[model samples]
Target chain A: MNPIPMEQSLMVAAMLFSLGLIGLLVRRNVIFMLISIEIMLNAAGLAFVVAGSHWQAADGQVMFLFIITMAAAEVAIGLALVLRLQSDLPTLDVDAMDQLKGGDDA
Target chain B: MFWLTSIVAIVATLLAISRLNATHALLYLIVSFLSVAVLFLQLGAPFVAAIEVIVYAGAIMVLFVFVIMLLNLGPHAVEGERQLLPPHAWIGPGLLAAVLLLELLMPLSNNQFIPTTGTAKHADHSTIPTIPTEAAPQLQERMVVGPKEVGIKLFSTYLLAVELAGFLLLAGLVGAFHIGREEPRTSAKPGAMEVPSQEGPA
Candidate 1:
């Protein structure tokens, strides 16, 4: 049997997820927002691993592998977009990319 | 041991998200990932723990650092980050996250919600014996789900998902290449003048 209870382990994942959510909501930098999204994905992976351990199943780890794969792909595209954005814009501030915010009217 | 690592992960993650410098935040995030890998180890998912360290702390973080360096963010950028994140900026999100955390924890704290321990479905599968430690006597005879079983499951049950993941990665690679490539200056813009000056030298 594992020493720590499953609930407590899940609580840790929850806290991490919440922190990531806060980061996502507060940070204006696109890179920081991407980092926050990574944190959230990691937290979700933690929860899956914990549940797998609870049931003594390998399915959780399989899911985690998928998560890691998805995160890798996402980071690749996101960083590429960031590079493109940096080349076009003077600043990395997300608010600066407001060309689509307003309608056709001035 | 588990609690210690969990605390470290949480604290490191908190510090990571609040940093003004991108590189500094990435470093803290690495530390946080390492701590979580330790947690994965304690949970008996050694395979996952190793991947966590190798991919998260090693590969992904290196990618982040490379991008930050390529961007060459100066002190002015750090100053801009500070302006973007004032002391007052944290209040609303912090409160919202706190409330979400409370909601997640309230049920977990209740005794009635604790899951009952039962025999594992794969109890017959081979498990590596763990050495008894003074700190965690209960983990002495715990079942360790090693990489062998995970590999079997991946190939047998999750083969389709693996193929899909590979396809997704390929698509991402092509997309990133197209998006990241420098565009030719064919448009009638100010930068179009510079294109001929570079070609004249050749």
Candidate 2:
């Protein structure tokens, strides 16, 4: 069995990051963008795990743990804001939301 | 050997993002995350992979799917013509990919990265106890500390952080309730006339 080197894992992570970025950039729906953000966060966590494993360092795994915690907090707040925004504005499109002057709070 | 599974995972993730359906995107996302978790296992870190699947893919994705269902996000109703990727949109991603590829893979001068010609993995295959070997980083002194170790670590070393996370979750619950459980927007009564559009400001 061929051992997967750190480099290969990193490359796969890079691809995931790119896919998420593209989705976030191109998608109009706010929910989709939020989902993409989660993907990016997951990729970052995976990278840390990869590096940590290669180095035999638990620090990377510990860091990945923190990242997950942060991600959970972020998504919760973000989705709430999006829900509020949808209430005020019928659509999730950023362009339409721009019309609401006070929507920046969301 | 495990790299093949990792490749499959990456492809699944890409497919998920490319698909138009949100549910399908999420299903593929789970597949991708699972494969990455397996890769974690192969890297001698089963603990991390377990956490990966349990926390990120399992708990978080359930919330994500629930929100999608709540939103009732569906295919575009108009859905006639589709536009190609904008030329300008490709610049940032393309450049980033090129730089990352060059930097991460450039050191493979000896091609030792493949590990195809060596006993590197074969040694760990037959003799290595999958769980114990993979968790070598955590189990140092033949301690049979199952989930209790995690509990101890979380309570002792990460207590404050855990409390903070709890508070954050509390806030989120409040916020979700605030956002999703709002009063109706329509001010007028059901039978009440929507005052005929007055063209100009008086």
Candidate 2: the clashing residue pairs are none
lDDT of 1 by residue, B90-157 (tens): 55435434443453345335421122111122333444432223323344445556777788999999
TM-score of candidate 1 chain A against the true chain A = 0.91
Q: Which ranges in model 2 have alpha carbons more than 4 Å from their true place?
A: A1-3, A101-106, B73-167, B181-202
Error of 2 at A71 (Å): 1.7
Candidate 2 per-residue lDDT, tens place, A34-83, comes to: 87898898889888877876766555666677788778777877776765
lDDT of 2: 0.61
Model 1 - which docking category? acceptable
Candidate 1 ranges beyond 4 A from true positions: A100-106, B73-126, B129-140, B186-202
Candidate 2 lDDT over B1-202, as tens digits, reads 3556566666767766776666666766777777776666556555666688898789888887766655543343123112223354344334433443343254234342222111123433432233324344433322221223334556677778778877877877787676555445434221222232122221
Q: Give DockQ per model, in order.
A: 0.37, 0.27
